[model samples]
Target chain A: MKRRQFIRTAGATVAGIAAAPYILPSGSLFAATGNRRVGHVVFCMFAGGVRNIETVHMNDGNLLPNLITGAGGISPDILGGMTALPAAAAQSLQTFGTVFKEFRYAQGPTGHFNGHTTAITGQYTQVDLNLRERPEKPTVFELYRKHNNPATSALNAWWVSNGLGPYPSLNYSNYPGYGIGFGANMIAANSLVNADAYSVIGNTKNFTDPQLAKAAALRDFLDQQFKTLTPDSARLNTASDETRLKLFINSLYTKAFSGQFNDPLQTGPGVMNGDLYNIAFAEEVITEFKPELLVVNLQGVDVCHSNFTEYCDNIRKSDYAVRHLWDKIQATPGMANDTVLIVAPEHGRNYDPNTLIDSYGRRAFDHTGDASSREIFCLIAGPSSVVKQNQLISTNMGESIDIVPTIAWLLGFDSAIPSGLLPGSPLTAAFN
Target chain B: MYIHKLNIVIITLVIILGMLVSACKKKETTYYYEVPDAAVTGSSVIKPNQKSTLEYVSILYADLMGQSIPQPELTRMVTAYEAFGDDRIIEDLIIRNLLNRQDADIPTTPEMRANPTQFVDAMYQRFLVRKPNDYERMYWVQQIQQDTSLHPDILYYAVLTSAEYRHY
Candidate 1:
């Protein structure tokens, strides 16, 4: 009788474990990453404003062959045309997870800054959203940093952008209780570490670890005295962490000046742009830190405002970059088979073209907050055991603002964040 | 008449002798003591406003070169420093770069090692624009005495990246 009862209990527990997601709400199923399926995430903003027509809709030819499938044939005017020479992924990205084909950025001005802010903060900001100011809402970085167990380091979360501009400020926010202490490590990959940057900091003296430690211990003593007046910004990295970061940067300076700093992922000249460069840096960050959360922003497609042909080519380039990043992520030790990569545009471009015509005679497009500009697509690919495989959500089930909470929920830190901070719910339908 | 005059002169001379005798006595003097400035600085209260990026680079350049940096160099410095999230590491790198330059107005390591007291005092005045108080001076001197690898370049790097230096 004891054995029969034990078997019955075991069977009941298995059934309950399998059925808990349906019984409970999406976010309610798990409150922490240990119990959740996936913890690592890579949120890539296919930025600079892309339209669905060229991407998910494929009204032209299929520009993102590695990411989006079913729509075949390459666009004739696409720069250098499409080639399968380099396999983007083991398979189409949609095969690995779900694709939200008809997502929307429901609110806020359809500008790059506003879109990025909304996506990162999970709130709909207005026209007052300045390009240079920190987001009024707490960023996902803050939410992750402040709530994650074992008190994660700044290295565990990275924000890689094509350019600094307003991107540097997005790592943390001006929101009270969640500031620089909970910010991500930010790198403007395209501009921060070029040959010019190497020229500025190339020949810094290299101190040994023991020497640096002695200096750092002394610095710590000084910091203890100045802690009261040193702003939060000044203490973003701990004395030891700052020392480590300095050493890492010194290494980068050496590598950059030595001419070994170029990204190997940029296979061809046509694919060489800021987007891939930024992704290459993201790959480096992932390799180095194996961060739990890393957000990458690509802006090459913003060239669409002036040249439509270049815009199409840039979309393909971004696709290639994101594909290479995933490939790199899977190749990484701690992140392999564990990291979930989410790709979505901050917002979409307008449907109609303006007067500017490119050399290809194609008219240029602008994202002027039109109805079509509100539409976007979010593709989430992860392990088959974790993410819904080959699932397609075409009923406009999600919005752009949902990305923050969605990320938090996947990382299992959503419950720790105050509900009021994230106005959007996790797109649970895309997960198992 | 002659006798009366001689008697008056004698009396006057005696009185004058008495006055001289009274004027020949000794006198005393007084002295007071003073205290030196405290060991730690008053930097905590003085620098209230944060320096703008422009001010920071310009001042950093001037402090390193003993002359104001060119506007173009200053602009590049500001741009390079502002192009990241954490200014601490970047500023630390910039400090090292500036100090590594041949034109940097800093004492040599051997010169500093020869006289740690003067090195600490000069550093306090040079980078922090104040005197290293008694404890600061003593602690730094002892540090330089103990740690053979602690060079003036590293000390300059430390002070340049310190919170007190970032202000004002």
Candidate 2:
């Protein structure tokens, strides 16, 4: 039977029990206290400081009748690719039922690392740029795994990155009592592609002799590197649970390398090479794993620093990628009616263009020190479909950090969980 | 009946011969560039100014790139170290990996069947770049040895995945 059909049947059977309202214990602030509304949550980081001018506000100021204007609402354009708007509209276009059009990262540092860090932890602290350091607090991934899968061993969550940087270390945090054990599985998709040749070497731990098999050769090589490398001090879990995750990761690498799943690079829509490829991998994960909490980071829009023309081009492509990802999720056997997709840029770009010009003779842009860098938008859709169509919540000044609490709430964590761990609140308007 | 029995015998012989032939065919050889190790004399002593820095850099490079370090890249790193008197190549490569599109491959080790302390010590040397403190060694040894089912390879993997592996 299809996973969605089984979920529907099971949901129907448990509707009555799930509907009963019950208050959480006042003392247990970190534990989950509510019924799950959605079985899966896809949090797209939408990184690299997307600008409003070329994105949501592309219809305004320039005086052009952009496709966003044709869509009948000024706000829906922020969704970029969720709508039925043409990808080549005078501007990028996407449709969704609800948009926090005037959403703002009212708190936190506006740098790339800070924006993404806040997106995960929901606090706007000034973090060091140490590649080895994780957020000092409990991240949403940790809380979700701890509360939702306390006793289970299923791979419940993952964080996939378009590129490798400090981002891979964000899977968990340095919070006491909550660290690697509660971390999400992270995959740098670009790196996975490069390592394709090595994943088939088999599990090195299983081999007993150095000359017996390829596994031994791999083991010998790894041993040499291990002995000579200066270790990063970050702690990781090596318990039986972690071992399970490692095995699972190996399986994913093997599958990805085998080309059993679709690779955007091989079948791209004629454009979008970097971040779009990551989005395709994210889609594949949703279809294959159906992880309960999945976060994907895409940063191709950062190219705006030196190539505005390509940046604009990428913005349009990003719109299409989002739509494609959503469509894939909808078509997946288990995720169609069981997932909630939340999309938001980490932060926005500077208001004015930089002096640099691309080969296309277009003005380049940067996000360094502009107040407009704080401008951002968000869209939430699906599963409950509780949100009214074309709904706009412009009055609420939201922080990037609020996404974590909102995600926690959507996944059935107690209200206290967010209140205790985050400095922001849920996007309450999207819920029933 | 006698012809049927002969047919069955012949079929079984064919299957056994095919298995033997396939098994005896030349085994496919796997190639890997061996990373040189820094010799540690005592349980806690490490050779200073050892080649461990380059090895560490390669792993970090692989971690970010998601593949083994290409020979040219490795040569460039070694050359940079010779010229600069430091392994700053690691930092430069890390930044390059983050800024560009690439992949990586982390090497794997054999499981520790016994001698949990020795295995844990090896991990501390491999990933932590030092010997485990007395307390850490004792604790890990106790943890793994008592739980014989615990795989030592898991511990090594855990360290590789740690925050320590990422930062200076």
Candidate 3:
């Protein structure tokens, strides 16, 4: 059967078995024998204006002295001033060292749509909605799913959000799996609710056939509700809005068809109000599904539009979350030696010598200015077997175009698939 | 009458002698004169005082023409003229004139031309008193052989340094 039809039938089977307990013995048998080589990639994307000088290149005496270490050394001097990590957690960060050793920023326009698209695709498309117009060029995630074959598993690829919009759904070909629509804050809330829901249904941890069926039914209901609420007119507003809505719809549709939302709600700490909530959701997803490839786009550092003073604080929070995700990945069972973690900002903020406020009050400036606005960081940390360990690789001429190719390379696929469109060199040094 | 006749004969003889002597004086002695090497070769045709002007022109040609000019011909033409020893100054002045006359209509050669080298050699020989060295001679001949422009200005420096205008 085709992948989509198989997913649909599997979902129906899980649901049908749930209503009747006759298939419980067979479900248990299948769960015991299922063996898959799972790989997970966590992307800590600081969507909006995170300045290089403040977060990554903090050498001068700035606000967060502890987080802003001078050149050459790894540890920050003033550990107490950083608000992101707790005292003990901050101490551990000093040992983790700089993750941005091989990272480099790109020069381009500073529009949100342009920067985000460049960050993912490695090519700057003038039209934001051009992906839909031209679907031949595949996204890194889409390519990964195609290579891995998502038909045999319960979970394939998960896009858990922290701050950014729902993952770009235009890149999704007819993939059988769902992309969870819950934003970082929303996902944490849903996980908490789902955890409670799972408990009340008397299915804790072990996802039975019956539980899968019920989750699929709920997913189908939610998909119908979302489609009813979001009319064709509402869905087709702008390119970005349409892209986001499609992702929401696709996630609901995939979940309903796959019966993979068996453990929908699993809640954690009340850190959902700030950047910590994003970290919590990422940690929750990593622990729950153990998905082969997971992309978590953290967006709170873009809080520059709201208040300029808290920009540094927001970046610190993002850094704290990055450290948290790395810690979890290392601690996880299968992810330790196989997984790769990447961190980078979607775009940088403007540079201000005096009060840290640009014209847009969010470091908004020309796209291809100096190092201040154009410069960003990219950090990759994983097992020595999968990625080079404890080495500072040169990134002199690297651009945003390299990200997609680098991801494809790490996944052991020829990234030259989008040859003409991307035209970016893979970060070869990052991997062994 | 005898006395008068005798006086007349003496006077006539004296007059005749004076006229013969004057005639002899008037017939200037033909001296076997040797031509100076400077005059023959036109090397020293330009006096030391006039060396600067030629030198200036040579400099102007070199700079304006760039490395594409045959170096041997330039060196030979500049060295042959006394005024061109200080080629830089003379060259500057010539360049200034050329710049001023840039918009003026340049005369065109109607006939099919020889190579640049052959033209340069022919022009050099036509203007100079003595022929240049085999290398210098061949240099302009080759240039003219390549590009046909019978106009002397095409080989202006070579023509200027030649022996043809030395007397003038």
Candidate 4:
């Protein structure tokens, strides 16, 4: 061969040799040794266009007191200057783990759905108004389900959405090699378990155990026959898991009717909203399943679009709910001391207030994808042994796309998924 | 002369009976019956695309209620149904809820047990929009025949939530 031809051939041979192993082995990209720091992770997309002025900024820092640390960025007097909050079980989350106060969403239109897509898929997305469409890339749930050691099922991956819209579709994607079957089990907690739903499905027939068994058996037979013709008829959960879910749903209905769910959140000051109810129900899920990967988004703060005062109030309530979630996780038997809770707003709100002003003379804001809107914060809190304690980073250290890879790394299977798929790496500073 | 008279009487009675038999046979009409023609092709192939949430709820309502659901009710059911992530569990609960309603247009257990094939064929046409293949017909028919605990409500629930029925 001529010299030029020899160089081209050698390059192709070497590239092929390097790629052959990852393509052949379905295990790990770098053959990782499976050792995990934490067994459970709860990713909270603390969304609804949170602005830094209300949060990390010490002047107006009462909004997220549970998260902001009184270290280098703010003086202790700022926290002391704020009105006292209701006493809670745990201390500041930042004291328990690391906080990146100036984290950036990096690239993407600051739409709520786009922010969610970035956080869940770990990839920046272009503006797409179709909130109902699945992400173009595999979700962290799919990657974990497909690549984790000692393969797990759908129940282990749970997503609890505050309301509706695109929240339901975030559990899975239309990406090839991953779809509904490998998707996470999700529930729009507020929408699925509420007074409205109770009014309708509350008194549904309670099938006898034997009758349910017969129906399940018959369904399996029909499903098997149908699967022969249509391969994709298979669903995410298995038969037994499906039964468990059915019973769980039934129990929710029972609770709704049995007077067990009598205004769990207080009315005045307690701020009964979908976001609070969402985390409340997610606590129920954690109690039941103790899922390995749980993603629950709270967006009550999005009211900033119209009511600034309510938004601030919601911020306070949202902080309380988040802290409550952390406390509940600590109290749960299996998840206590073993779970990592990662909370971050999907994106920030516009710096400039909108035309409307609330009764408190504060103007409402919108997430217009401006500079302020692109700035957000992230808190990675867990047991101090696994996560760094009382550490705070005020500068921009990580991007929104880093969450998936961070989750993969914490779960100890980062090398299993193709690194090229996730441009972001684990936020190592948060961990030891 | 007397024996000849008796033989004539017997031959006359035989001719009268033959005429009566032929007339009775002509009065009866011969006809054939088959299953109602399916809106879709009568084959084993299923619809290519799955039904949307609205479509599934509408068709399921129509199939069970034997009438179109009201617009408000359709929206309500869809909202509640879409709330749950697992379609299987939600579908089961809804199916059971609908089956318990007084308006649920399912065949009575006696009606189903009386003629298994007719009930199975009606269900296939109602939900799947096609006839059940031989194996399906045989299996379900046998199941209905042998299984004393089989309830027509569950039979309807099974076929309604079947993978094939999820499509057009």
Best by lDDT: 4
* CA lDDT, candidate 4, residue B29: 84
Docking class of 2: incorrect
Off by over 4 Å in 1: A1-34, A77-90, A127-129, A213-234, A261-263, B1-46, B113-118, B138-150
lDDT of 3 by residue, A20-122 (tens): 6543222221222212222556665666656666655554233322332333322243333334334224333323332453244565566555666566556
| Deviation from native of the Cα of residue A255 in model 1, angstroms | 3.5
Off by over 4 Å in 4: A1-34, A70-85, A88-90, A199-202, A209-213, A216-230, A263-270, B1-46, B130-139
TM-score of each: 0.83, 0.60, 0.45, 0.82
Candidate 3, TM-score of its B chain: 0.29
Residue A416 of candidate 4: its Cα lDDT? 79
Give the per-residue lDDT digits (tens) of candidate 4, residues A1-432.
Answer: 999999999999999799776652334444455578899999998999898778877545456766765433222433332223465334689889999988999887999999998999999999586957999999999988888876788889998888777778888999988888779998986777766665455557666878777877887887766533444754889989987887787777677677655555433353467877888788878877999999999898899999876777677778878888998999999899999999999999999989998666667899988999999889999988899998989888998999999999889878778759999989998998
Candidate 1 docks at the CAPRI level of acceptable
Give, for candidate 1 chain A, the lowest lDDT window spanning 10 residues.
A23-32
User: Residue A190, candidate 1: how far off, in angstroms?
Assistant: 1.2
In model 2 chain A, which range of ten residues has the least summed lDDT?
A60-69
- Mark the regions of model 2 whose C-alpha exceeds 4 Å error after superposition: A1-31, A60-96, A149-154, A195-272, A416-420, B1-168
Query: What ranking emerges by DockQ with the best candidate at the front?
Result: 4, 1, 2, 3
- What clash pairs does model 1 have? B39-B133, B39-B134
The candidate, 2 or 3, that scores higher on TM-score is 2
In angstroms and one decimal each, the interface RMSD of every candidate reads 2.9, 13.5, 47.7, 2.7
